[model samples]
Target: MNRIEQLLPEEIEKRSFEIISEELDHMGVILPEDEAMITKRVIHTSADFEYTKTLTFSKDAVAIAKELIVNGADIVTDTNMAFSGINKKALSRFGGEVHCYMADETVAKLAKERGCTRATVSMEMASEIEKPVIFAIGNAPTALIQLYNMMQTKQWKPAFVIGVPVGFVNVEAAKELIMETELPYIVNRGRKGGSNIAAAICNALIYELTRNHQ
Candidate 1:
């Protein structure tokens, strides 16, 4: 077995990023600046380099997301885990907040009455919010489908979307549907994302914004 090297508590993350960058370089995987930042963060979170290929971005998606974040865009997530994982304090600096309506009693009741998943109702509730919204979906394809449906009817428009739901059922289809739109989005092309990834992507963007502000 290889001996573990001594590392200070704070050095771990910095060293991890250094390793991620070196590996990406060794693989000849060069991403554009902002996209690279997001990609590296995703890879760091999952320790999966496959994200270099599986991650997709709409044109200027990262830039647009940054702009929205600077303007105080609120984020709506499909899962509480994702909601909890985001850097709330960092986002709050820009007057933004993270929301996960999946646990709301009203959402649950409405979903049962309408025979839809809580994700669907949660999205519906999110559409009613007046602020600029960014969606980070990591667990449910239904939420993406519902958002697409709402977009079709002109009932809702998100400033940006991170559509990375992980599953075999309808996950790929939902991601494809979102890609068909002109909306800005960061998505994983396959069933290879999770709530952790979604939160990581959000934090990545927020961290970038923090750097720009500083």
Candidate 2:
């Protein structure tokens, strides 16, 4: 089995099979009594992609940021420290416009020095940004709720969201948000995946999309 498959717990594996079956049923993909084989195939298919990588935090963020730019992301939002760092290098290397949102002025200034177009913690500005924004949120559930509500009110339907909530608080929040919104997104599994992991997943998606496009 691949690394991801090995990482999957028995419960998650069972749950994934159920979800796949439900989705197939919804799509009218009828199947016979070969449910066990189908489940194995589903698990294998799910594990086909490599989602995470081990890199220095900065390198990880930069890699993801480049992918976002390539995939036509105009504005990149980093609500946490690690994302801010990654987004900074990405903005510099990609030389496109990027916006950094943070509660701390120091972080914002750092982001600015690294080539961010605007750095602020203002939700209003975020709400006003145009569509197809790339949102990277940390592990705070309250923050996720607020952002989601803000986007809903503004009618700003993001094209994609990269959720990498690292700690206990943010990880649960991220999972809940994913299950609730069902929006198109990429997420890291478990609390072990902090800002860097989230950035990496976003990077992987960007790379995947870019390769597919080319």
Candidate 3:
């Protein structure tokens, strides 16, 4: 079987529901009764994908970066919070020239200390990177738009885009932006995905893409 077909369907459904429930709770309100009726609709829309993967924490992020490196990814962008628990050492140990980007200064310093060659929040820096940008923005569509605009203006084409936005706002919008590109991409289905989960999805995408290529 292809790797995608081998994924456990039941486990995927369980994980998707858990993620959606957690995100809705975190949003501080349940959907209106009308919207609630559409719950199956949402799930059905997302589940059309043939592959699904779940990620928990830092180790997942490290594993993803390693997989991307093995697949010949040249640049990796870490767009999560500064101290979001991703293992920098694992990314460093993968032994490729990986570029890291974060929104916070302390996180950039930490990534640098862990052997990331370049770190910055500037979209201009992203333009200069020579490899595909593995972008992980935690459910912030505005931020994703900014990045997209930057790339569009510069006419820079990344090898692929892995977008993981896990939050209440613009999750779907961000996913749409990534999807519109028609590039190889990965994303979580709904809200409640924080930076950690988003990173995990990226990791899973890397694993899938690398395995497929091999």
Candidate 4:
């Protein structure tokens, strides 16, 4: 029989991080403070420690993301689930908002007319936002590909990007494409990410901002 530890509602998250930190230490994994914060949150969300190896970050990606959020940059996600999981209230505190255009009627129409996936068209729509934007893409490789093209052509440059789409298709290749660029990014290097993980990373950054203000 397994013994379940009792915890208060507020204590659960703190305790979870305690366990995550202990396990990381036991495994001899050492990470920079900011990286460890994001990694721990991802592990807390997925209960998978393999992220310690698979999660890749461009230099100062976490710091850049936090600064963007602080400057009221908005976030665009590939899936509604990721959009919904973000803490809108906390983001609002920093004058930021989260958006997901995947369900927009216009995006669907454009994708159909162009014969491209809605994810592809959605990136184009996101580019038109007249503000600094951070993209959190976790379910569509097409979205990542589109962003890569947009960046290469100088059509749009995001403040930061989180590319962790999950699947067996072009998921790995898409991640590689983003990693090849000089843009700031945090990507799970293989095919093991999902919308939920993407949201976890966003929320981790938001939570860090909130913690600092407190």
Candidate 5:
């Protein structure tokens, strides 16, 4: 019989946290509640404990993100997958909504014409919105690059940025670029990230606000 089969589902999860926590304790891991929550969830998703180190939170990123989310900041995603994964119903409680421009024809055309990625064009589009946006980029390095450049050039900033694009190429470089900036961000330090990480962190923040406060 499997070891997990011998336990209840809740027990299994409880044991898992206990194990992860014990492991972190051995490593002397200490973090604020909000950062720890997001890190734990990421570890839960990937089953990789390295996330405890790989996860980087700009000073007070979760707190800032919560304030933006609670104030109804618009969230712009790099992919529809990230867009779909966000807890929109919960976000809407604060008058916030999610957006993805990858499917927009105008963005596509501009991307093709400018020899840039569709995500790059989409970010340019996001800049036009009147409300401050929270950028959640997960799958494209170009998206992070464009957004970072735009912020520097235009001095326009998002309410917060989540940079966790996975894979090689410019992924690590893009994340590094974001780190150099003073923009508030939560970034997966290496190439180990994706749309799910981005969505999960956003949801974690939402859950933190609605559940932790209540």
Candidate 6:
């Protein structure tokens, strides 16, 4: 087998990260520790280097996210794709758990009753978790909207929000709403994201924490 073919997926990913970082440097992108973590993962997800320029973050995004993970916080994803993409073992080392309630019957019923998207209602349900919560939204703008509304109400706030839903619907508007809030967030500006992007971002944070702690 060829060298590339012989390499395991994790090895290929590691080597790819090295290449991606080198390319970002050539393009004059000097990212901070946390920003690099998110940017690289997003690029890893979409293979779109443009994300290096498009992804935005709150001042304390990574720090706050790491803190939440270290505290065994629960991660809530907007879709099962994101939920399945996270590094559960790494998160579990810090007592964190990943959750996705999009398929729940109650969420469906609530969304229908409230005239809102199921993703939005799911966030309301996720907000009830007693421990710190991290929201990884990758499939629905409505979820981001709901979270932003909660941020306004002071009724619920997550340790961090990764809003990278991919679509042409209310995706852009929902992300814009999130930016207006004071919550720590890592958002892909524009409508180029999805559950994979969201999951990659979450894994990036978890991986970084695992690396830094080691």
Number of the predicted model whose lDDT against the real structure is largest: 1
Per-residue CA lDDT of model 4 for 135-172, tens digit only, reads: 99989999999999999999888778899999999999
Which structure is stronger by TM-score: 2 or 4? 4
lDDT values of the candidates? 0.95, 0.48, 0.48, 0.94, 0.88, 0.87
Q: Arrange candidates by TM-score, descending.
A: 1, 4, 6, 5, 3, 2
lDDT of 5 by residue, 1-214 (tens): 4654587777987787778788888889886777988888777667888888888999988889999988889999999999999999988888898999999999999999989899998988898888979999999999999888887887577778899999889999999999999999999988899888889888888888888556
Model 3 stretches with alpha carbons more than 4 Å out: 1-68, 71-75, 78-84, 97-100, 103-121, 202-214
lDDT of 3 by residue, 167-196 (tens): 676666766775665455545455544455
TM-score of each: 0.98, 0.48, 0.48, 0.97, 0.90, 0.92
Model 2: weakest 10-residue lDDT segment is: 48-57
Better of 3 and 6 by TM-score: 6
Please give the RMSD of candidate 3 to the true structure. Answer: 12.7
Error of 1 at 208 (Å): 0.6
Q: Give the local distance difference test score of model 6.
A: 0.87
Poorest stretch of ten by lDDT in candidate 3: 48-57
Off by over 4 Å in 1: none
Deviation (Å) of 6 in candidate 6: 5.1
Candidate 6 clashes between residue pairs 3 or more apart in a chain or in different chains = 166-193
User: What's model 3's overall lDDT?
Assistant: 0.48
Best-to-worst ranking by lDDT = 1, 4, 5, 6, 3, 2
* lDDT: worst 10-residue window of model 6: 1-10
CA shift at 139, candidate 1, in angstroms? 0.5
TM-score of 2: 0.48
Model 1 quality (TM-score):
0.98
> Predicted candidate 2: what Cα RMSD to the true structure?
12.5
